[model samples]
Target: MFIDSDIKEFVEALSSKEPVPGGGGAAALAGALGNALVSMVGNLTVGKEKYKDVEPEVIEILKKAKELQEKLLSLIDEDAQVFSKVAAAYKMPKNTEEEKAKKQEALNQALKDACKVPVEIMEYSLEAIKLQRRLAEIGSNLAISDVGVGALLLKAAVLSGKLNVYINLNSITDKEFVEETKERIEKISEDAEKLADEAYQIILQKLKIEK
Candidate 1:
């Protein structure tokens, strides 16, 4: 696993012609930012005089959001590393029949692993969007904008994850595996869009409308 410093170097690599920190890495970062925004809303609601009755629940939400954020941040590196592995597998020598079969198997497995990571990212980001919607309804009035921000970030994550899934699907040779992944990604993307739209409407209704 890459450390924080390594992640910085990875981002610099992204700035060049590198492909590892492409869509997959960007999706992970979007998910992390979404989770972090949800944590911010939770923190803002906790220990406040008006929100005292819900303070305990806010604390729990804050803890969970923080944990998810940390996990998503780490996934940024994980996604890049897995992508690099897939690239390496593709580059393996295959002059002999046995070596060709072995390299193909390795490439297939690497592609699967790469696909799974982005799927996990999409799932986690959808969960974060759900949390943002809930918080927008009951969170501190002043912090509703943060909930909106969370929703937006999750939307970005969902779209970014979809891009990674599509790219990986092009490399996958298994029909069943590709079909299953496509179905799952479609469902999650639809749900994420709905959640983000609802969050946007709620925030506008709550904070932007003139009383």
Candidate 2:
């Protein structure tokens, strides 16, 4: 699996001309990395004597973070597969009227499916943002910075995922789908940025960093 591959191989694949491991996949992977950091902070908080009162809550957070991490990791491949289908649809022969119609139909559906991969990424990334907000409040003081970093990583995922969504949305002829998706993405991006920035500020305050 792509996720199982070493970092160097994965980076090479991402840098290659192949379209599968493109922006959508990269967004998912970034989100996964963010969630992993959240999980780390959660784990670090759960067994500490200083955090005993909140151990249960942190444990629950750890479980959720792990689940999100795995789901986002799987999404890396899912996004790639969806993009491959879209790419193949685009390459479909259009030599005749019937063939042209078929290609258009395939491309439309494939594009919509491609849009879905990034939509999932945006949704998952939002969840990561919200999760980070909680961790910033109760996570281990030593790893509070990780919670902030996680939030920023999720923000990157949300923004990059939106780029993938917008590109596909532009080619989609479904007016209702286009408008609804645009609205949702706009809200997600706004919420994500605000939450991430707030988390970072809170963490910096907690750590007494003047910067």
Candidate 3:
């Protein structure tokens, strides 16, 4: 997983003619970054005299954001690994009837597993966006910009995740599964966009009317 590679190596891998750390991995990282920003806002709101009334609420949001962030961070690697598995399944031998059947089964299972990872990312990122909206309202005023950053990151996550969903949807042979997954992805995309827009507007309003 080479979790601690230097910036140069990571950038090289990301830019090199490789596809492992593609859209799915990027979406996972974006989602994690979004949660991280929300966590920062929540942490800054705690233990401040001016924000005492909202301290308890901020504490809860911080806890939840940290949990979500950890999950999403882990998914960054999981998404890449799942994609690699799908690629490997595609390389299965298909010479004989038995080999063809085995390849088909492997491809089907691999596609399903790959879809699950991005679907999970989409659901969690959607929740993170909702939390960012709430945090924008009661978080530290001084740190409202970070809430805006969270909203942006979540929007990136949503769009990036959609790309992963689109790519995986192509491999699915079951018509029902394809239709259902497409519907779910569409709904999530709409909701995530709306939430991100609302959060951004709130940030703008807060900054514009700052006393």
The TM-scores of all predictions, comma-separated, are 0.90, 0.95, 0.92
- Using TM-score as the yardstick, the better of models 1 and 2 is 2
Off by over 4 Å in 3: 209-211
Worst 10 residues of 2 by lDDT: 17-26
| Model with the higher lDDT, candidate 1 or 2 | 2
Model 2 CA deviation exceeding 4 Å by range: none
Over the stretch 50-126, how does candidate 1's per-residue lDDT look in tens digits? 99887887787787787778778888888988988898998999999999999988988899999988888998899
Best by lDDT: 2
- Per model, state how many residue pairs clash: 0, 0, 0
Residue 29 shift from truth in candidate 1, angstroms: 0.9
Candidate no. 1 TM-score: 0.90
Model 2, global lDDT = 0.89
lDDT of each: 0.86, 0.89, 0.86
User: Candidate 2 residues 108-195, lDDT tens each?
Assistant: 8999998888888988888888889988998899999899889989999999999999999998877898999999999999998999
Best-to-worst ranking by lDDT: 2, 3, 1
What does candidate 3's lDDT look like per residue over 1-211, in tens digits?
6245665775677777788776787788889889899988988889999999988888888888888987898887888888888899989999999999898889888888898888888889998998899988888999999999999999889888888887888977877988998899889989999999988989999899553
Residue pair clashes in candidate 2: none
